[model samples]
Target: MDATPVAPPTRAADARLDRIPVVTRSHRIWVALLGIFFTFDLVDLNTFAYVAPALRSEWGLSITAVGAVTSVSFLGMFLGGLLGGRLADRFGRRPTILGSAVFYSTFSLLSAVSVNVEMLAVTRVLTGFGLQAMTGVLLVYVTEMFPREQRGRYQSLTLALGLLGVPIAAAVSRLLVPIGPGTWRWVFVIGAGGIVGVILSVRLLPESIRWQVAQGRAEEAEPVLAKLESEARGILGRDLPEPGPAVETAESGNIRELLRPPYLQRLTVASAVMICLILGFYGFSSWIPTLLVEDGYTQTESLNYSLVLAIGAVPGALLAWPLVDRFERKTLILGISLVVTVLLLAFGISSGAVLVMVIGFLINMLMQMLVAVLYTYLPEVFPTRLRGLGAGCANSVGRLSGAAGAFIVGGVYSGLGYTAVFLYLALVILLLGTLLALFGERTTRRRLEDVGSAPEPA
Candidate 1:
């Protein structure tokens, strides 16, 4: 008889069988660091809006110019998300993250020195490119670190923690605007400080062993995995199993891969949900303070109202943490969409200031819940290799929709009136709810591969 030849184990086969030990402490620490980084990114993105009144008054900027400044960064984010994912796939997650931090930090500092709208716009665009790239890589890093069963909970928690930046930014803006001559500039300075913390912490963190293994550098991955395993044993008080092999489904990280059969359908649903969510979120959020001011509130009163709105988001985010893992993601999304739609319409039609504040709080709450659900859903629907690329693309598309929302609300607020603009927002939310109810897949209790495989025909 002829001797039988043995074949090498494929990456997918190795990943399917191997079970890495879980170290909760190290995982939590890493998640905290990433969350802090994301917080800074959010601060940088929204700080401009918080300081918009000051900037417009100082520069005599038209409403169109203010909208343009906000939209420019989002346009850069759209491009960054697409390119950044592919770069992370090629160069490794750690490098992409660090590079983005350095790039955005530098540009944020530059924004403080801008003398004209053109210069400010350019700096924001560059800052946005780096900010979005870091965000894309961080999502992949967080998702890959956890097991499929705990992915939703982990993602939701981190997202909630990251959103703490919203209130922090708004608070800082309110406090500084009264004391400083260039308070908006100071906001950018604070954002720069946050990036410095990220740069230092990220250096001490380990690269993803799964990513290393996928690149066929198993020997390099071994030491990292061994260290992680040792940490796990310390926490769990038992020896842990080895991690399974890394899987590589596709070599190309191009946009074309997202359009391939299974991914295309998932992408479409994710994009639609994202677009509608942003329309609802930005429609009210971007104009909340202005609306309050128009309703006879002082600047101080408007700022306080905005703070209240930001505070409401904290509970919404926390509520999602446990339920994200417990319920169907689609159901959560659909439920929040309906709640937000109703609250926003009620807010628009109501006449009492106290009632408006109460309704605004609820709207903020449900919007944050919708966002938590979305972050959990998008990443869970893609394989480890494609997670960053797919999620980034979906997020980028959503950012574009949000930019449109800013323009639409700003344009119509003068001509169509605030009530009309809000009704239009309500209509968008209704359509989004319907789409999610009908097309969104149930992802709770399912593995990433299973979720990815459940996509319908494109």
Candidate 2:
């Protein structure tokens, strides 16, 4: 038999993947498809808040019970983030995304059929698990998709499209929940339609080529790379640039590695940021409608107010898209967090409806900006080998904290009211923002391979 000549390793795959221009037809399609999935995910996530007042009225549930229901969902999301990240690393991002969509959509359908609060809570938790884990995976995929130079811009655009679903959900709830008895079930029923995401993900999204190269699955990565290269060459009307040096990467990702050295610091800072951000987020966003209802505003009035507030999310995400790449991620995050604190405080203290609407609009805008910037920035700090795991674990911490914060808000609101909740959130945002400002890794405009290849901290 003739001797077979060995081909040199194609370890430069990450560099090649990174070298593609950020603007291409395929990239736009990916953004649109993923943005659609994210839109549905946000709709499902915000469903609980919209349904809560209805549940309280229909089930005669206490404030604590409503909080518990929300908490259970967060608990599920926490577990999902942990498991989903590991699974994505082991299996693939495409499959994980598909699985999460189906899992959450199925549970959301079941939640609609629940006969009582207990059943609803359990179903919502299951739905939340899939929804949240999917979110973590989605962020990982998105980070790996675009070149670092435009990652923020595209991610922000995707988020803007997705956040529009919040207003959609709020509007839907405004229309549906007020219709008749037991109409709240329709909110969840609508969320169950996220099954469409599974179909789109399977048919449209490709596996992360960067992930394939990092895993040393060069054979599997070839076709994906070819398609990307072809697209890039066609757009440039010439040959592709030679890729930079291959990144040195771990053979595989594991949680233990994340606990040590460079990753450990990123994990610590990311977790703190995630926790405080979610606490502040849920404190205001998730609790606002309930707080309004509790304060004697009618359910319709509360949802109407929330709907108006939700409208600002789209514009907020849009505002962040351009600036996301213009400024350092941490600097933008810190500045936005400070603005959010001021607006949150303003919203809490002001009693005039006109003032409230203005402040609420500003707050929602800043919150969406915060969300877009963080999503763009967090996954960049981890190596492709451990990106999913690191992002998942850190995000799960936020979910866990959110689970607890839900109950705390319930108790605090029941005792001290919205002002206290808003003030506490302000303090939390300040501390966490400062921590991130001090410790965050700078990844703006750097190659993923370069950013992820640095040595451990001393």
Candidate 3:
């Protein structure tokens, strides 16, 4: 009789053999560190908004000029997300992250030294290139680090913590704006500090084991997985299941994959949501202090009201953590969109400071929450093979839309009035909500694989 042929070792079995359970403690620590990094990133990105009035006064900037300064960053961000996503896939998440961090930090420091509006615009563009890379890479990292069950909650929490920078920037800007003759420059200087710290801390972080395995670098991934497993067991008081074998289905780093069929749809929905959200957010927020100033409040009072509005975002971020995983992603998005639309209209129509503040608080809460949800939901819709690319494309599209929105709002607010501009924003938000309800997929409590695969029949 002929000798029986042996079958090849299965990928799943091979993965099981190489599996290492990660420690919860280490995971939590890493998550906390990432959150800190995000805070600085937010501060760096948003400080320009808070300091806009000061910059305008000193530079004699027109509405269009101010809009150009703000929108230029988004232009860079648009390209960065597209390029960085592909780079992360090809080069690995760690290198792309490190590179972007260094780039942003260096440019942000240089921004403080800007001598003219032209130089400032250039620096802002460079800073945005780096800043945008962080978002896609960070989302990929978070998804791979946590297990499927807790992915939504953990992502939501991290996002919420990161958003703390919004209020922090607002508060710090208020403090610094009043102190020195050139206080706005100090805000940029302080923002640069956060990026530097992140760059240093990231050195101690490990590369993603999933990415390693996917690249068929099992030998290299072993030690990292072992460390993770040991740490997880220590925290959970039990050994966790080892990750499955490295299945290299397709190259993850290629940007072209995003243009393919199902992925194209996912990209479209995500980009649309981003455009709507940012338009609503920046349209109202960029002019918050100006609005207050127009309503007869002193500069001090305007800044104070803006501070109050910023503070309200903290609880909003916190509240979003649990709900993100519990409800359908699209539903949460739609609900927030509706709430914000109504609140924006209310805010525009009202004259009383107290009433405006109340509406502003509600609007801020919903906007912050929507951001967290969008970040968490968008990535979940793409497979690991193209997670970075999908995220990058969506983010890039959103940034482009945001840039347009900024320009449009600046022109409209300058030419028309605040009420008309806000009413227009309300209509945009309502339209976006409708689109989400009609086209957005439900992703709550589902595994990333489930969402990332081809869509099911209607």
Candidate 4:
């Protein structure tokens, strides 16, 4: 086994670390653990959507009432994003991950036991809080742990694997929800999938090497690096490559740093991206089955419609692997949003069962691709010191927008009908592209230490 030096690379964690190529034993393990962790997140994410129609019938709730439940869940996510990143930075990524798992697991169980919509909404809020917290930290962990050159590809790979959970949730809901009146409750039980994920995480997940060194814990990073080198050397069948040139990195900064100059503009762009994403994502994806139900489809019919649409999620995420590293991150985000905009418009005007299915599939496919790319692009904008908090704040803001979007879409659908809601969604997506195109800075192929919202101070 190759012995790791006692100290971290002089410049920062990326200096010697980037010399290791994209794949290694450690890389695969990290990706697998993150993927599994995110898998349960996705499963829980779509659970309420799948159960909404049944919820309407059993609870005798209005469509707006159901939308309000979804809205409150976004409010919960807003709190989670606010806390997830700052907590990760202050506490540690692995501990944050574990804590989030425990929270979602407990609340999801509470969600299942809801005797009234009030109880369900409250539990769903807590569940959303934990889920978003884990999500924000995980995004930070993925970018920090992986090799710099192929960060986007690996992120896509992890998400593609995670995309499996959508179909799993869809299929499970389809199977369990309609079995009887109370079977819908069983679906929330599935959200406990995090319990298994947390177990796997404890066995395999390492604290992020970059985060460790950033926290002035090089001793902690060393053993992890040594194990990685030993595994990588076996794969390479020779000595490791020479270290790359070092790039400057800042010492740790407090959460308030995200509000200061240099980072403020980037925070604005990131927040815009998050808002646009939530507006589009919550308005459409979360409302799919409910949207169909509102349009006169039966509960069973809507669930079937969503299950078919779920087919596109995996391929959409997998498709990002090739294009993510190929194009400039900012330009690529704009391009994908353009396609998603057109697709959303097409879906709104679509008619006939087959046409609706086809258009929805295309919209979801491209949307997942957009999601994978944005995750890679967003973190590249912040300094390591504040990356998690910045991302968390941005995501929290988006979740706040998402709460408004759920209400806005439901109100629009009720007032103007389905087409108007879609038009509103398309507009939000276009705004996302426009904001990023004008203000987003470039970060393609540059080392993380070298890239920033503004040039580093001399």
Candidate 5:
């Protein structure tokens, strides 16, 4: 079903990959390994937020200071997005993925040994960088390797696996952070568990076959392709389907192609969507526990509340699996954005514990659905040669806003109070919905080459 490009990349080759009915066993192993890697990505990403109360009591961190640390780490994510995308574009997705796992895991371990806020902030910056870098490339890898029709949901499936990290963070923060002094260190130690993922990835993951042919390294793609074909054959209990009809040979292009006509439009739309989404999503999620404490809830009560809300993440992603394949991705994102806006407004105004929990859970579910769909869509908008770079460009710019969001939300919460901050988040998602409605392009179930191609004349 997949292949090494024996000649230059051909329509025949792309057809072989596109028509594969199921993931081969060889490739499923990689998917499981990648799921482990991203699960840890979520763990390291949220560790700081979950442990904020402990940091406040033990190290005297104020909300303003938490904002500072959060902003700086997001800035690191901004850089990592750019750097990782470029690396993946040039060096290939496999190495970039493996290399970034090492980069982040090392820094996540370093987080456990931080002596003070400054030390923690420094470690967090590097950790954030590696996490984003790893993330951008992984999404690109999925875009290239997975079946075209099923790509969107597969993206969500991996994310659903990764979202397990949310509950992991919640449980550890609740159970371990309360055990007196220095216990929060145990949470960071667990965050460093990406090292285990990296080891598994080294053994189980294959170099991306599509990326190889895109770079004209057909020979290198052969062995991996053979193993995948064998597995796929066994699963089918017969010979593979004949390759589909070939279209024109799709010429590969680089990042400059995105700076030109069709992709530039898509890039702008994606960046706008991501910026607003980051503000709304991160504005709420990044500040939840800390804000609960600020509202006069005890740390223990806040963690209990957070743990309940974190459980929503898995269902949120799972809920999208069918829909992601069923609808146009852009339309789905716009619809979810509208729904999240309404829920956020309710979250802002509610006071009773039951009402608040219900609203929060819905918001978490819809937001994950939005995120899973959006990640699937991002890589689809660009050509394979520069897919990583293009997605990273938009993603990094959005992350820059994500950094700003910590400060913006913190300042708004400090000056105007909690309800006003949620109001602001409502406005942000509303803006996101408007942008998608206006400029978002459709990418559902299209070939990567065709999806990224310039429009045909009417």
Candidate 6:
């Protein structure tokens, strides 16, 4: 009898998929779709910031009460991030993303119809739950799908696109919030349209091939791998290059493994960076108009300033694309964080409107740069099985800290001053930069397969 034919190794699918070059038509299309998905998340993410001042004026809320409205959403985000990550790892990235889209979209419209502060806060908390979990899953999907060499660049593109929502939210609020009483409700009404994109994403987005291979579903992974190979061949117009040697990796789908060796350090570092960044980001960025209003700027002037500040965020994100592959992500994050610290300090001391706007613009720009870099950096540290869980857990820390920071800033601003709040933000940012520079591992131009599976020190 003839000898039994042997099956090709399963990891060949992974090897084949990884060898595809970046910047293909197919690749660009994928980025665009993911970018649209992220755009909605950001719109909902930032909706409250623009509307909070209006809400405060309408409800006759105290500063702490306004901050509480903001903080409640983050409280929901904390749970959402943790739960979303676990679900993505357990079920699939695509489904979690779809469900999150539906959940947030429905509740966002409900917020518009809310009759009182308490009702609006409840809707926002539910909205936050879906919004953040969707964001966590989006990062995981992007990290897995993009080419290793250009992962940072592509992720930055999505970030730039997502940051556009900030400006969009600002523009909407500037136009609508000043019209008359109850106009703030229109902000959420326009934002509810983001749900439409979800239907499109469910149809267009591909399931992650790396995820399939990691789950030991080689048979399922092969067909997806073949499609990717075909796309690469079309782009190259020739035979593909040989894939690198495959390293053996454990199929760990457990959250417990995240607390063990090879993952614990990543968890710690990502969580630290996330916590500080979110505190500084939301503590300042989301609260910009409110802070300005307290500092004596009119609502219209504050909204205009915020709109200009929001415009800077797009470039801030775009600037990272060219440098992301060239410089190590850790170094870039550190540098941007330091710039943010100085700008925050400068912003605290400045007096003139032009000066404040200029300083605020610069600060927001640098903040977005930090955002692009960290979003790219954090997801690179964990394995496919734990990528969602690890990122989710880290994101939870940031959300919770951000919630606390919002409250602290409100209390401090009400008692101490804007100067005190800026000082606190600057200090937090400085420590975050220092910690990342000292302890974070380099992930420049590294393949996801190698970066994800490589052994770490105990």
RMSD (Cα, Å) for all candidates, in order, is 5.0, 3.7, 5.2, 2.1, 2.7, 3.6
Write candidate 4's Cα lDDT for 141-192 as tens digits. Answer: 8787777778999889888988888998899999998888988898889887
lDDT per residue for candidate 1 within 1-458, as digits (tens), equals 21222122333432532354353676777778877877788778767777776777788888788788878887878788877877887778888887888788889899988888999999988888888888878877876666556767777777777788778878988888656557678888767645654666765666765566556654555545545555555666655454343445434355677789678887898788778876777777777766566567776777777887887776777778878778788887777788778887888788776887798888888787877777777776776566678888887887777777778888878788768777888888888878877977777766554565455334
* Model 6 C-alpha lDDT versus the unseen true structure: 0.83
lDDT of each: 0.73, 0.85, 0.75, 0.84, 0.84, 0.83
Screening candidate 1 with a backbone cut-off below 3 angstroms (N, C-alpha, C), the clashing residue pairs are: 14-245, 15-245, 18-244
* Model 6 pairs whose backbones collide: none
Error of 5 at 380 (Å): 0.4
Q: How good is model 3 by TM-score?
A: 0.90
Estimate the TM-score for candidate 6: 0.95
> What's the ranking of the predictions by TM-score, best on top?
2, 4, 6, 5, 3, 1
For candidate 1, what is the total of clashing residue pairs?
Answer: 3
- Superposition error at 110 for model 4 (Å): 1.1
Could you tell which candidate, 4 or 6, scores higher by lDDT?
4
What value does the lDDT take at residue 418 in candidate 1?
68
Among all candidates shown, the one with the greatest lDDT: 2
lDDT string for model 5 (224-296, tens) is: 6656556766787766776665442434556777788887888898888889978888888879999988998
**TM-score, predicted candidate 5 vs. hidden true structure:** 0.94
Q: List the residue pairs that clash in candidate 5.
A: none
Angstrom error of the Cα, residue 440, model 2: value is 0.7
Instruction: Summarize candidate 2's per-residue lDDT along 98-170 as a digit string, tens digits.
Output: 8899999999989989999899889989999999889998889889978778889898998888887899889
Can you tell me which runs of candidate 2 are displaced by over 4 Å? Answer: 1-11, 455-458
Candidate 1 achieves a global lDDT of: 0.73
Tell me how candidate 2 scores on lDDT: 0.85
The true-versus-predicted C-alpha distance at residue 133 of model 3, in Å, is 1.2
